[model samples]
Target: MGDTFEAVKEVIVEVMKIDGKDLSMETRFIEDLQADSMDQFFLIDGFCEKFDINISDEDARKIKNVKDAVEFIDKAKA
Candidate 1:
């Protein structure tokens, strides 16, 4: 996996309170990880806080999967 994937996975693991070892680029926040609605919102908030940037609703809406999140944050950091 790329560095970007690793970073985003870190946020997902931290926010969802799941095992880091269990997270992957293919991991689904809801189905695979069993994350609820609150976990979803908290994941977004935690990601923003970790990156020190605000991810707009439209941009966030694109993040349906881990790959999308990595791309989003990679762009934001760039």
Candidate 2:
């Protein structure tokens, strides 16, 4: 995982109140994280702030897994 990926993991666990040991790159936000759209919104906001980047609503909607979110931010920066 990249730095962004690691940061995302920490944020997800902290914000979503999930067990770190239960989370993996493949874990689905809705299915595994049991997060609602509101949670997703907060996550996007927090992620962008933490990473000093911007994430559009459309881009945020495309996120499903941890890896997906990390890749989105990584690609945006690139």
Across 1-78, the per-residue lDDT of candidate 1 in tens digits comes to 398787787888778777789676777787887877788888889889887879988887777788778878888888
Q: Taking the tens digit of each residue's C-alpha lDDT, what string does model 2 give over 1-78?
A: 468878888888878987787667798898887899888988888789878899888888889889898888788778
- CA RMSD (A), model 1: 1.7
Candidate 1 lDDT for residue 21: 90
- Candidate 2 overall lDDT versus native: 0.84
List the candidates' TM-scores in order.
0.83, 0.89
lDDT of 2 at 28: 89
lDDT values of the candidates? 0.80, 0.84
Best by TM-score: 2
